[model samples]
Target: MEYVLVLYIEQALKKGVVQTMEMGLAEMGRVLRQRVLLIVLVTLLAVGLAGAGSFLVLEPEYEATTTLLVQSKQTEKGIAYNDLLTDQKLVTTYGEIFQSRMIAEAVIERLGLDLTEQELLENVRVRSSSESLLTAVTVTDHDPKQAVTIANAMAAVFMENLGRIMQVDNVSILDTAKLTSDVLEPVRPKPYLNMAVALVLGAMAGAGLALLLAFLNNTVQTEAEAEQLLQLPALGAIPFFEQKGSSGYRVVVRQDPRSAVAEAFRTLRTNIQYDEAGKHVKVLIVTSTLAGEGKSMVLANLAVTMAQAGKRVLLIDGDLRKPTLHHVFHLGGQIGLTEVLCEGVAPEEVILPSAAGPDVIPAGAIPANPSELLGSPKLRGLLSDLRIRYDLVLIDSPPLLPVTDGQVLSTLCDGVLFVVRSGEVARDQLQQAKGLLERVGAQVIGAVLNGKQRKRSEPAYSYYAAPEGDPHD
Candidate 1:
């Protein structure tokens, strides 16, 4: 029984190992596909560097070679089999003699070259053929002519000294060393070959590095990740819009109602209107984990969309420290939220109506103590009054993690719409924002994934502003 149990455990362990390896391979493939452009760019850059090094950075070397024939001194015309074997054995011995210090010194002296015996020998190489009585000697140097001179000198010196050293006059020169001066092709630095090798190596390195970075990046980039990490339903994914020319912060519903950006906001509005707490979400606070995440733009668009849907929406710029709703609605920002809360101004007097369908209450003044003001009971009474008057009240608050304003104001609203920028806010920062909302007993109904870039393969509706003619006609 114990043996069977151990066997089962071992089998289970093997299955687990296989499953882990398969999962890791699948993740690697995903990273490779996602970062293909990065890998290609890195590979091209590396190939360029390699080409530069091979052509301009490294020194070129030239090689010259000479061949020597080893034979027997026996004068008999009829050669014995034993004589052939002896010649074959002498071929290897003669090869070693070609690279000997004595030959190197003699060659340097004969050529009048200023080099040590060891240094001269370092450039010389000797090898014998397996099926012949021939030995080849090669010399390499930076100068082509010098390489040829060294090869010829080494061969001559070896021939002169071989008879005295080996007690046999059998070696003879078969071929002389030759030199070629082709500036187009260098022997040592092959630029194309080096670049090709570097291309492959750099691609592998770039892929590995991209995979490592993807693995280490703990950020919410997709809807599933936001839902999984924060345990909140992703209300919508707001596609990224290029803010250029006259298009500032896109109020898509009014500018291009049929475009994808406008369609996305409409989808977001529909999702917000039909969620579990949709009917009860009368006064909702919209804020993100960090600043510059387009949370304010999201709130403005949501409010515009709701009002366009026949709901009376009151848009309040709750971010007194750095307010943007006033600029967004072209209202006076110097006396909006601060005047109503601190100076006892009426809500109806400060509300600015817009053609976008939403009435705005901009953050009028930049108060020194924003957190204290938002936390005051007067602010709560104002929100209550607005909620009673308007069908929907969307408050654009400061970033949750940066200041205590969002967290403090979250308790006064019906629910909090946590906005996270895709590939912007770290997972830890998002988690901290969630934790703060939880600690304050704030109701977080759902989240919005902002600035998601649409894939190139996906259909775009950028030019579809509206229909050409009225259908009623």
Candidate 2:
């Protein structure tokens, strides 16, 4: 049993870590997909602009090649120049004689060129063919005429310098320098290649950055968030149920079963069980850090679910400033929590049946001092009275911040269940909400994640699996 427990705990912990990383990747994929069209368009535009610019804006330079034959001065040893460098030893003297400043300057002076020795040298190239006694001399320039003139001059000077310095006719120009009849231009700053590579790199960088941001965002973004960021059990999820009622856009949980909205509430009930809470969970308060988080809807649906389980459940719209139970139940706000509190009306008298099966009490008339109303001894006495008559009471109160209504009412319940919508409830909001609940000393029973999607990596609960027959193998 101990081993099993340890293994379970380890699995749960690993799942939490993996879930966080996967969520980050999932968010990255979503972002990439959303901007895929833009990425492609940008890539095409970049490559197109680069290719066009390379072809039109850049002028093509011409190349004039002159070939020279390298023969060995070591005919005495019957060793050929071809047996140098890659063969046995490099003819260091010949190589230096060709690349020297003396030969380069002599060529420049004889040609009456305006280029510096270094600049002129850049245009001249000496190349040796593989395992051969032949060398090729090449000069490239923007002007075709200058290219050919410079090539021929360089060859004459190199040969003269070799004869004068080394006293040998080892280097001979095989082909005199000449113009290419098929005069062509060069391709550099390859815009198409550069732009294509840049665009691709940019896309990869963007995706990688998005993934990093997602991973660093430790706040809960969805049901996957609850399991990953907090490593906590998700009590449930309740969706926004919309239907045409006597009032505009209210939930008909009984009439519209199997809807995505309905499934949310049922899922919430299942998650509640995941917390290992006592089966007799009652007197729950639903609240968030800020207003407009669908806390009331969650409470209403939770109450309905409890009622469906044959429990006498009462839903109280504790948000005295802004009520919703009366509107959802179509009670016209005639009699509700405000009326019962102010006039001392009985709970049974103000109780209204909901289309979803919960008995509800609306906020009634807006209270000038909601904080005082929630803190009053009468509210506590009323809760004490209602607790005996009903199996569960779900109080839908205002947000935790901007008022003390929720914190005050939470004091009258067993625990407060926070409702956070995916991408809607930010990390700071949850932290502040938790801080407030802690300040008020309210028991924060696990959270109910709202509008969360299941992840591919997360294992789905098998609570509602279909009945099946055994198959013979």
Candidate 3:
């Protein structure tokens, strides 16, 4: 029984390790996919530079080789095994002598070359195998004819000096270095080979750079990232969309109700309704960590979506300092929330109606003390009165970290729907903003992850889309 239990534990541990590895690979693949364009551009730039250097900057070098045979003096009874062994041993000595400085200088003088002994020796090579008695002399130069001439001269000088230095006449030239019109290809500055190597190295470097950039990025990009950082439930994920020739806020739920963005808003509405089993979120504040995160646009569309579901919804622009809902709904912003809060104007008179099914109350004017006005007792009373009149009241407030207006409004509202735009707000900023709301004892119902990048494999609203010729489309 003990062994069985131990075996079971081992199997479970292996399974857990496998699962962790799979998850890590999946996350890496997602990061690579997100930065594929940057990697491609870097790779192409490297390849271009390599091609230029290979073709335009570097000089080509040509090589020519001559072969020589080293043999022992043959006896009348033919060659013996010991003679062949002696010749093999002599091959090594002959190879070194062929690359000596004396041979290099002699070859340079014989060929009338404009090069020093060391420089000519640097371009010459000698190779011989242990089992063979043949030595090859190779010389490289910028000009093909110079390379051939140097190679043949080096072999001749080595043979003439060998008889005088070692008193041996066993070396003979087997093949002379000959230049031909058909065989003038340079050995160095191989453009195709260099480009291939550069291609591989550049791709590796680009991939590494992309991974480093992904690691350094601290922004919240996906719904999972937002939920993991803020510890908040994701009520809905709205994919990003853009319409040409359209400006200001986009009420996609009202204009193109059959589109994917509209479907996302409707999904958000359904999730909000089902968030709490027996409770309903009546007065909600929609806010983000920073400005331009699309909180106002999200609130406008959410209010319209709720109203489309047979609920009386009121959309209020709660940002007193930088009001934009007036511009969004194309209404005059001279008299709305500020007048009702500071000037004690009646809320019913300033309330405007829109064709998008939601009652709009734009921010009246820029206020010097937005935090004080939002935190007033009269403002609480106004919300309480408005909450009773409408089934759902959605307030678009300013960013939380920039000012205290959103936190103040959170205390007066029934719930807060935090908006997080993909790759816009950092993780620390969202954490700090959520901490501020929590400090005020706000009821954060859930979060709405906006501007999420949709995957290519994931079809957007195609199942609910009407046919091309259909009137609904």
Best by lDDT: 3
Instruction: Tell me the deviation in Å of residue 302 in model 3.
Output: 1.0
Q: Model 3, residue 197: displacement in angstroms?
A: 4.5
Report the C-alpha lDDT of model 1 over 370-472, residue by residue, as the tens digit: 9999999999888878878999999999998889999999989999998889989887788889999999999998999998877655676644554677453
For model 3, name the residue pairs that clash. none
- What's model 3's TM-score? 0.85
Ranking by TM-score: 3, 1, 2
Better of 1 and 3 by lDDT: 3
Q: Estimate each model's TM-score.
A: 0.83, 0.65, 0.85
Whichever of 1 and 3 has more TM-score, that candidate is 3
Shift of residue 80 alpha carbon in model 2, Å: 10
lDDT of 3 at 76: 98
- Ten-residue segment with the worst summed lDDT in candidate 1? 14-23
**Count of backbone clashes for each model?**
4, 2, 0
- Candidate 2: give the clashing pairs: 85-89, 236-268
Worst 10 residues of 2 by lDDT: 464-473
